[model samples]
Target chain A: MKEILLNSENYQPGLSIDCVIFGFHDNQLKVLLIKTSYDNKWSLPGGFVPIKEDIDTAAVTVLNDRTGMQGIFLRQFATFGSIKRKDPNFDSTVLDYFEIPKDAGQWFTQRFVTIGYYALVDFLKAIPQKEDNHEIIEWIDHKEVPELILDHKEILDKALHTLRIELNLMPIGYNLLPEKFTIPELQKLYETILDKKLDRRNFLRKITHIGILKKLDEKKSNVAHKAPNLYTFDKDKYEEVLKNGLNQGW
Target chain B: MKEILLNSENYQPGLSIDCVIFGFHDNQLKVLLIKTSYDNKWSLPGGFVPIKEDIDTAAVTVLNDRTGMQGIFLRQFATFGSIKRKDPNFDSTVLDYFEIPKDAGQWFTQRFVTIGYYALVDFLKAIPQKEDNHEIIEWIDHKEVPELILDHKEILDKALHTLRIELNLMPIGYNLLPEKFTIPELQKLYETILDKKLDRRNFLRKITHIGILKKLDEKKSNVAHKAPNLYTFDKDKYEEVLKNGLNQGW
Candidate 1:
């Protein structure tokens, strides 16, 4: 942990980036979190921004360093800035974890303004990397996320809010689900993200009318009930909608 | 300007806030900008965030000080942090405007990471206040916004992008329009914000289906063509939809 701090000599003193990496599996949305050595509390994958790199690049670097994933769909959602965001208690906990003297941990106590970036990745494809201090990385269900360090819980909540709003306007669900999915599976994903029950008939009608889904000639395999037809996203039509703009908010 | 800098002794050293104050008038969207005292270049209404105040509070204070309007709908959208953001030439220009010595202007030359906030206001109500260094305050049409100083233009573009996306999920148009407006007027407002021409029949159908507008018994007066029925936003219904969530991006 101390070595981690020493390696951040080129980082901007008061700015950092935190990533809320979301994935969907088993009909549940999940977020990747790391257990910090200090207090062993959970937190979003985050790191300081090096002064020489762009903030967007820094966010990508942090994501790669923590998740060992590349080319993920990432978006900068919000910036969190409060005077006491990095409280003295948290700093002391870091000092204890790193075994660094009080004076040497000044860098950890300074006021930090963190930019929040949220990424959507395929759950099975992501590989978690162990850090010097944070050796345990886990993908916690969104509903079961524990209390995180500092304002990380608030950041995660905001990321979820942003994701819900974005899902309404963009085809971002493609990043979370498998390449081929059934209508019920897609509806389940929507329900999980929105945290509400959507009318199946209406959802199916609306999604079909969007013209972004292509019906395939295949059906689900070995299902207890009737197997539903599988479909894939029409990337060209989705791109067209993105370029020509879709009618929103009905 | 030097006096202004001196008064900001309590400001956080490397952080600031910039606002994109948007208003609606004559069926056109407008943005409020201030002309710099040094080179007469236009820029967004912005200032440093005081060390003792929260970033959100600083945004409101900056908006009130520059636009003389409070309690407006202001939202922090993004943060801009590029390495060459605070070019020395710009700092020199500020120093030249303030008639400060080179050594004394060192404080002004430091790099600053700025948070971008956008405010929606009623054009007829906001009263622009003149500052010591910025005596000229102008509300230019969105399409006619001049080249702004530093990265203000990019900030303004991002603000507009956020505003367009937000308009779909939330009823924010009420903040820019009058208490009562015609359906055509509302459609035009959407068109201007979206920067695209929408099918009138489709737009009307979509807007009505949203169920947020209440038709009044009044009609537009002094019109060349047929007088359109007037309508106002149904606040309770809008809030209900927002609470329960609306089907978006169709």
Candidate 2:
């Protein structure tokens, strides 16, 4: 037991923060991912938490460095820590041919306890940047997301779950969609996230009753059927509802 | 900057987990507290995380030791860190009281980064116990709580804030009340935590519509005025609703 306990001394410990930035496009939810320039491996945009910084601040720094957006809705979701999760091979098949070391022989697998935060941003508003000039950055739809470099797929899954659970109560989907969206568009966002279909009339009625959507007289220009009226979220009203909370839908 | 960083090495490093256990009784929301046996100071029931253990597991272990409950509704709410949050107060307090050399000063402020977990429990079902037999454990209503020894009061406040924000969607209140309670009892509990008065009839209607309450034929027999009907949370239904989400309330 003593020897086992002492082994912890050799364990290099550190903290890191990862941002699972979610975006919505083409009626599908997506996460912003960077294809590492070094190894062509894809993963969530992340970085080490500085010793002098607040952990949440470190998360924002990571997001801003990669996405060039500040003051976004960044939420600390959960902290991931499994001894096996720290294994370098835990990354996807892309690393198989890299001839990486068994352990910290690779910098990526060093024992790190990472606090995961999710950011909901209008993809159009995000000016994606390559930090440390690594690989290509892309926004992959959640459904078709690649087998990411590390436990990034797992991280993205967790962020989606948090979003689904917090969707109605918090002002989230607005940040993921276009500035102006129809009721069907908004409903489709919820449907994609929750992985379920909803009665269109019921969903529309509920959302409209919330009193945060400003109905615009404009309609979908090119759609074949009757064009649905466009609506935009009243930012101030949405913020008020978020601060006070609503009890209508999951 | 290099000199300041080097001077920080003189501080020992450690990690801690704080459990903010919320309990409800007599229509008042309360929190479980333990008076530190070390200095007769009041604080939340918390302890250091074992190096080999997962942080969440360590949180559950500490909580079970303090509350004698297993697998309750516990959640990692936030992580607290501040340079001064880990000053050598405990050792100094002890040394000043005993008039001893502060040789063991590091024993007190060992630069700890503590992750905070907020838990909800049916106080009547829990068997509270002290990890250290000498620790004085008690339940104090939120308003009546004492000035805690460390940053515990802030931890408790943050936990409550998380609960209030989530109360509309999650069935967390069930953890604070008994297996059977009146609608009024549940409403009172919410009012206490939210620090506001809710319309009684409106509260009942909203609570019942969630469809998680199983109304029993029983009633409060000896209470003054009209006796209220007894109800228990439909566990299966509650779990289902959690998946579905409770999304409507003012």
Task: Report lDDT (CA) for all predictions.
Answer: 0.81, 0.73
Q: Looking at model 1, how many pairs of residues clash?
A: 0
Local accuracy of candidate 2 as per-residue lDDT tens digits, B1-250:
1122211132113456789988888777789988755665688887654445677887888788878888798888887755446644555665554344466454454445578899988888888896445568988888888888668889888898888877766765667778888888888888887789999888878888788999999997788988989989999999988776676644
Residue range A1-250, candidate 2, lDDT tens digits? 1122111233213456788988877877778888754555688888764445567777888888878887888888877755445645545333433433344334454456677899888888898886434368888888888777657778888888778777766655667888888888888888988889999988878887778899888987888988889889999999898886665554
lDDT of 1 by residue, B1-250 (tens): 3454432255665678999999999988999998866655788988877666778888999898877777898999999888767755664666666666666665566567789999999999899887774468989999999888889999999999888877777765677888999988888989999898888998889888889999999998888888899899998998787666666642
Candidate 2 - chain A - TM: 0.82
- The DockQ figures for the candidates are 0.60, 0.27
User: Candidate 1 regions off by >4 Å?
Assistant: A1-9, A91-93, A99-104, A214-219, A222-227, A236-245, B1-9, B91-93, B99-104, B199-202, B214-229, B238-245
* Residue A206 alpha-carbon offset, candidate 2, angstroms: 2.9
Clashing pairs in 2: A37-A135, A247-B247, A247-B248, A247-B249, A248-B247, A248-B248, A249-B247
Q: What is the TM-score of chain B alone in each candidate?
A: 0.89, 0.84
Cα error of candidate 1 at position A146, Å: 1.2
Q: What are the per-model numbers of colliding residue pairs? A: 0, 7
Candidate 2's TM-score reads: 0.80
